[model samples]
Target: MDVDFRSGCPIAATLDLVGDRWTLVILRDMLNGKSRYSHFLDSPERITTNVLADRLAKMEAAGLVTATLYSKRPPRREYRLTAKGRDLRPTVQAMCRWANTHIPGTWTPPADFMADKPG
Candidate 1:
């Protein structure tokens, strides 16, 4: 998909791909080790199957995630973070930290989640 940038700003460019509420959540799930489609469905946020499928496809197209065949009989797949996806770790971590400090009910993300290594 051709991204028509509104400006040359880097933030605007990044937002063009991941500004939506669900995209970041999907990325966070991948970071947290939810590799299978079923695992994503089990998230507490309860993302609909259709939306999850769409976001996963889009992320794949954008080089963020890659789906590999894990089950042949059921034709199931598991996703992994590409280097581009791992690059979003800091952005996700910053958002989590901000929420933990500013949002009254928000809990801090685990230390490992913010670690450099992908789970």
Candidate 2:
């Protein structure tokens, strides 16, 4: 399968990879050390199981995340961010900061929410 490009712009190309709404949320959760499905489900947005599964599959295909089996009894899997995915931290952080500043709200994340980590 091939990607359908919206435009020749690099931003559009980048979004083609991480464009889906669920994908970014999944990435955000992974950045915050959320590795398990249950933990992802406990997130503020409360993603549905089917959507979560689909997003995981897509992320895995895009080399953004990797899944490892943590259990054999029920065949459970845990996901972690790959180096490529970790590189998205800056983009996500910038977007979050922009939203916080432009969008009207008294909400703010913790000081270390976007700390300098060697990812």
The best candidate by TM-score is: 1
Number of backbone collisions per candidate: 0, 0
Per-residue error at 48 for model 1, in Å? 0.3
Model 1 weakest 10-residue run by lDDT: 110-119
Model 1: residues with Cα > 4 Å off, grouped in runs: 116-119
**Full-model lDDT for every candidate:** 0.88, 0.86
Q: Tens-digit lDDT track for model 1 on 1-119?
A: 55577788999989988887688998988899889999999988999999999988888988899999989998999999999998999999989989988889987787899776745
Please provide, for model 2 over 8-50, each residue's C-alpha lDDT reduced to its tens digit, 9 standing for 90 to 100.
9999978988898788988988887889999999998889999
Q: Tell me the TM-score of each prediction against the true structure.
A: 0.90, 0.88
N/CA/C clash count, model 2: 0
Pairs that clash in candidate 2? none
Q: What is the lDDT of residue 49 in candidate 1?
A: 92
